[model samples]
Target chain A: MTTIITAQNLSKSFGSFQALKNVNLTIKKGQIVGIIGANGAGKTTLLNSILGLSVYDGDLNVLGFDPYSQRDELMKEICFISDVATLPKWIKVSEAIDFVEGVHKSFDRKKALAFLAGTTVPLDKKIRQLSKGMVVQVHLALIMSIDAKILVLDEPTLGLDIIYRKKFYHQLLEDFFDEDRTILITTHQVDEIENILSQVIFIREGEIALEADMEEITENWMVLNPTADNIDAARASSPASEQSLLGRTSFIFNGVSRAELEKLGDVSRVSLSDLFVTLMKGDNDA
Target chain B: MIASIIKPGGYNPFKALMLREYWENRRAIFTTPLVIMGLSMVLIIISMGLLGRAIHIDGQSYTLNEMIANMSAQKAQNISTHINQILMVSTLPIMIGAWFCMVFTALGSLYDERKDNSILFWKSMPVSDLQTVLAKLLNVMLVIPFVAIGFTFIFQIFLLIVGSFSTLGTDYSAWDLLWSSSNLPLLVFSELTYMVMYSLWALPVFAWFMLVSVIAKRSPLLLATIPVALVILFETLFFHSEYLARFIGMRLTGAHILQTDNGFGQNFSILGINTPLENIQSAAKPEFWIGLGIAAALLYAAILLRKRSSL
Candidate 1:
């Protein structure tokens, strides 16, 4: 697979506080990667650095261009929807369409309009007139119409109803995703997109705490429900996190053998949300 | 080299960016001038009705036409010159209105985008920071002036038609009396040139406003003005030199362009007769060039600030 983004020792600081600390990451083309992090965990900072919205230290490249200096050229191949409300409130739906069509060469205006025609967003109505969900829909339609190589979405559907959120990801996968294109998304509703992501990167306190493919995570990471007598045996495997409830104990282990885990008690696959909480809680303990 | 850096494509992005600027600020760029001109036309019509009713050439009542018919040729020439002067003077409000438009628009150009988080959306496009800032600058400095001039031309035509109607039944042709005596082509060319030169002269101020727009966290207009006001105050308090304030005043008004022999208010003939090229030749002094250099530096700073700005 071709690498679409590469960052080596990338760091960013706002005043005395470090926002991204020596983040080394490589994102390959054709992968739907989800960046999961709590608020102020530098998820937006990382996305900003990759999108060329902020200055950073060390080397960072997107689509073979330095995102900070060569952003104009880089943006020609990359399209981003930075949250739902970033579209100008004063712009009419048609004006927004015309603007993107005029400025972006890869933008297919006919396709964008056709997409909008399927939605309830009015072409003559200003963005202020549209509901938040409709605005996100309009933004999504416009972004998907652009024939870009890389698509980055930072909470593209934040605050949307569950129905719209599900529809958003479903339509995104059905219409926009292909082997030649890559998607990088970050959302608070991790469970909603967990099934669609090929890889998940968990960030904590400006550092990448965990990075693993979904298959690797599913195959290797296990959660074991242990009886009181078998708890010590489960602990020997160095589980990432442990929790006890109603006199039953559960342990989340990262790389232990399934047979070994099975000997302890009932073993099951760890959910991404549970893994994310366990990893973040583990960092807090560290 | 700068062109390549600012605009990767030949010309399409710049045109589109300008069009985008127009889209965002159509009220300031287009509708405001149209409204001002419309109001001026209404006032002119009202005054013409009032004058036709209030005044008479002799004891027997006569409309404005009989008064012009009874007047001597020299007096008619003077009246025509005064009429042309009134038309030219009427443009001053529109020009001032355009200045306010530029000032407010420049102040908000970069600030509003960041405040509303729309800068992220704009930056995601293929256009560079330099192109975006330059488009905003051009909208205020160049495009608005042309729009004001276009409205002014239309208003002038309407006023001329009204003046011709007011002078009906008179031997003196309003065309000959007003239009012929006023060298309109020269007037328009001169006015256009003056607008361009004035925009250039005032570039540093607008550029400074843009820089403040990008840098200030809140109240960009106050942030933009307070520094200059402090500097003026400091100059008066410490050095007792008003040179800075005078320089700013002169730049704002383009006082350097008006000839001392036929200064702005003393000779209304300057409006009709003076060619813009001649005005530029005479007023092409060191301050104008120096202001242009300063403007370039400020614009470069604005580009840098905008590139690093985040919301």
Candidate 2:
């Protein structure tokens, strides 16, 4: 796969405060990179700097074009989705599509309309009346229809229900995505994305906390729950500590290494949400 | 596999952005200016009827031209003065309002995308920063004027017809009255065209505001306004800050290049509605050309600044 987005020493500051400080990241084409961070962790700032909306002290290349100087060329290959309700408040769904058609030459009207047709959004209804989920669907329809090589979504499914969210990603993967397209999503809905995330980068306090592959993470990280009375035995065997009401326990153990961690009693694999919490709790030390 | 570059292409992104800008702002376009223009016309009709009735009571046998001549001389001075004021107040505010509305209409143009994390969408499009900002500037500079003119022109024509019916004593023909107002379209359009041409001189300011809008996390206008206000405040307290005042004031007035209305100042052997426009058009002043050249330079500078500034 080819490299789609590359960033080096990317930094953003607002007055005396730093929003992002000396960050470095890279995403290969066709890879789904998940950016997990709390609000104000500079996820959006990093994205904006890439899209050329915010000036940052860094070097960034999205599809071989500096997003700032070569925005028009870069935009041709990048599709980004934020909160869906922001599409256009007063416009009818059709008018919004006409607008997209105007701004972007790559916009596929038939596909956008087809996607809209698939939804319950009233064709002639103004966006102001639609529920939040409906608006997200409209945004999804338009974004999915764009023949862009890079798709950037920032909480695109904020208010979406389980079914629509699933359907949204499924359509994205099936209809809009291909082996050549790279999608970088920054969302709080981590578990929903765990299966799709080929790579994950955790950003904290304006710095990269961790960058890990999904398979390697699952292979290396395990959750240990010992029911045996001799918790001290598990504690001696484990490499990482855990908090519990009974006493201090540790999840780290050589016996539960990647090849045989499944044999341990009630040794459940960690979900993305669990992994994220672990990292959030674990990153301060790392 | 294919590469997209910001080369000069036949496609114009600015125009598309402009259409979206206007269409999104349909509410403000239809309502505010129409209300102001409608009220102004109503006042014109009432005042004309009152003036005409007084002429009848005085038993002065007057031609419609004579009455219009009197009105033009007396009320027309106020009318012209107020017309300029109204053009400035009603149209310019509406124009300024339209530009400001671009703030709301285009609030999300790029900011919302970034705020909501959709910059990736816009970045993916085959567009450049110059193209993006150019599209936005075109929306404010060109598209706003087109819509404002379309709305007010139709409303003005409607009022002129209504003003014709507003006549009393039945001696004045509506055709002649309309002819007076009918001649105004060219005057209004030409003058407005000139005003917009001059207004183009100030586009760097708007582009500056757009630059502010894109960067500010809170209110962009406030971010821009506070600094200028502080400078003004600093100058006011100093009282003798001639250098500061001269510097900012010169920059402000430098934008006045398209004032083609200072026509044939006091040189006419003959005078009429037909007179001023012809004199202005015929007597090509060096000032006009000089102003136009300066405005073009400013616009080019704005484009370059947009290109250099990230986002």
Per-model fnat list: 0.69, 0.41
Best prediction by lDDT: 1
lDDT for A222 in candidate 1 is 88
Model 2 earns a TM-score of 0.72
**Lowest lDDT 10-residue stretch of candidate 2 chain B:** B1-10
* C-alpha local distance difference test of each model: 0.84, 0.62
Question: What CAPRI grade goes to candidate 1?
Answer: medium
- CA shift of A21, model 2, Å: 5.5
Error of 1 at A1 (Å): 0.6
CA displacement after TM-score superposition, residue A13 of candidate 1 (Å)? 0.7
Worst 10 residues of 1 chain A by lDDT: A277-286
Candidate 1 whole-model C-alpha lDDT, 0 to 1: 0.84
- Worst 10-residue lDDT window, candidate 2 chain A: A253-262
Instruction: In model 1, state the lDDT of residue B115.
Output: 93
For residues B56-102, what per-residue lDDT tens digits would candidate 2 score against the true structure?
31466654456555545554345454333323332443455544554
Off by over 4 Å in 1: A227-237, A245-248, A283-286, B1-11, B50-80, B261-273
